[model samples]
Target: MKYLLVREDDEGEDELWGRCANVEGLFVDPVPPPREVLTFRGCTPAGPLREAVSRPGESTALLGNGYVEASDDTQVDWWELVDAVVLAHHPSRSDPSLVDVVVGAGVKGAGGGGFRRSGPSRFELFVGNNVSAGQSLRVDGLLAPRQDPAKIPMELIGCEPTGRLLSALRRPRKREGDWAELWALDRTGQVMAHPAVGLGIDGTRPSVLGGTLIDITLTDGGDDRPAPAARPVWEAWYQGVPTVPNQWAPYSSQGRSAWLRLALHARRPRRPDRSGGVHHLDGRFVTDVPGLHCAMSEALAGPGGYFGWGWDAFRDCLCGGFGLTPPFTLIWHDADIARQAPADAVSACEGLLSYAEEIVQVLEDVGVTVVLA
Candidate 1:
């Protein structure tokens, strides 16, 4: 049996402790053990896991989280405790007796909130009382350090955790219009085209039919190349549109990045959140582009090809960092943009190619590479 232990903060120990993902446990103390003895338990504690307190229960005491149970009840509940770990020196290299079974005559921590000792590593997540949709948990912890005494913000891992890491280590902040961005990479070490994301809609503002636009930059493909400090090429809407990576510039190198969504499109237009060029992708009607039907159909297979940014690619690109819906067959609505007949939608979609080209020019003027892709 594997379990985690949460205890009351006694702050009576001086030793080292190890915390990790698939590694186990957490550290809550304000001061860390500079140097001390450690103990290994359960599975072998290996690289990066600098273990100290050798023996469980025998090692120096560590502080655990605690909170008032109730004003009227005057009781203490374990779950109310904040998440954290303490450290102390130990002489042996062994694991905590985190897992123990009960027999006919025995029980453990009977009236205690403390869990059994950890037999293996596990992942723990943290959320703040006021942290909302667009805010990163990392930023909240850093900006309010004492509020996060346990250093719970340190352990974060995602595809593009750069911004989170910065928030954890540096605690950088936003001034007016700038949103701290996060970048990610794939297994191949290629930078993820999708950088940052936030939920599309908020429930508080009812009758809300749209989302915010993200700011981005267009930079030449180079390592030292810096994105223009001025403005981004495009700002994509967060909702009611396709969300996916339209293209990955094989031409780009490891040094440079293309903030694709930073200069992309989305359907929502409640009010532009961030300032930048806004290319609206009207989902309800096909205005500019001629041949593209609101829905996908065989008609797109022919003339719409030139103006097409690959159906899936277009949707993914539009969705930006948020997840994308898979491209599906087009389902036509009764009234058509052509207003002629059912057969004209396809040809009309092809007509939109000219408008598409015009938008391409608009993007190009802003230093964005609007490849046919």
Candidate 2:
């Protein structure tokens, strides 16, 4: 309910659009960005397909879809499912293409099942090196990751009739390129998440509830609501804005994960790295993977600040602009908490290493001096 929509002024400062009294589609279910899913339907297996799938790291290269093969152009909409893992390949169902013949994971149903495509297509799956199978493939009409949302309906209350909102609606063509950040706040005036959105011409109407109703386009519509288990953490944050360290230590693992996610979502643009400072990290609460990330994020940036949620994002943060630059000393207080907490394995070239070791290795690799205090 506490939402603030703000766009940049000519002077490059965020100009608030007053308070948003009522908003729809702002706190809706979070739809993750769509990934490329290789869906093969109805096609029978060939050349020891089951045996090839049983083997580890069995990759399958889909040459081209029916859409590509029917066309005259040389460009094929090709996709390869690397380390391809078969989710379901049962040929015993009544309808051959009703709801079966799932393929690959991660991008499409990691645990439950693989992604399914609608319609029909003729494609060949080259599995391993010797085995090959014919597949009826079709790419679904799901929105791609880079595609913008069609619309995000919102209503602003207490806005001036001759204000920027009215002005933008009057001449949408001239201001069509404008974008704004919609910042949602908690009950205690703490920011929840700020998603960037663009203005639109259509569906801009005066609300019957004495406000302006506008349909904005989402640049990125991240999930606004916290998890049920993590609601207490948000409530705790509402009790007091996290200014010091260890504020996230008292929450459960699930709550901590949600907290880290919220921190990641609420990340603002960072100033240029001054490039020198000893970032002291309290490791007493590094009981889980999420806790480790939460501590690291809060340590590097501030309370509710984010460095990274995972190793890749961590490396990205170290590149610059995430609070402290590398080459500075990271005096990790109570480092043994992480080292002796648990044996979490991380993928490495030689073999698997504990997550703690991986963290230290990543830090050292990035030119940050790590001190185990």
Scored by lDDT, the top model is 2
**Number of clashes in model 1?**
35
TM-scores for all candidates: the values are: 0.17, 0.51
Q: Model-by-model lDDT, in order? A: 0.23, 0.57
In model 1, the worst 10-residue window by lDDT is: 131-140
1-373, model 2: which lDDT tens digit per residue? 4677787889999887545654554544434434345445545555334443334554442221111111112223333334444454444354554333455432322122222233343444543321244444433321123344344344444333337765665673734556677776776777776766555434444554554444333333333444457767756665545677877888877788777777776676767775767888888888776788889888788897888887668888888877678788888888888767743322221223456667888899878899989
Q: Give lDDT tens digits, candidate 1, residues 246-344.
A: 222121221112222322222233332222232222223333122232222112222111112333444333333322222322233322342432432
Off by over 4 Å in 2: 8-18, 21-25, 32-102, 106-162, 167-179, 185-193, 198-241, 250-280, 319-323, 326-351, 369-373
lDDT of 1 at 12: 47
lDDT of 2: 0.57
**Candidate of highest TM-score:** 2
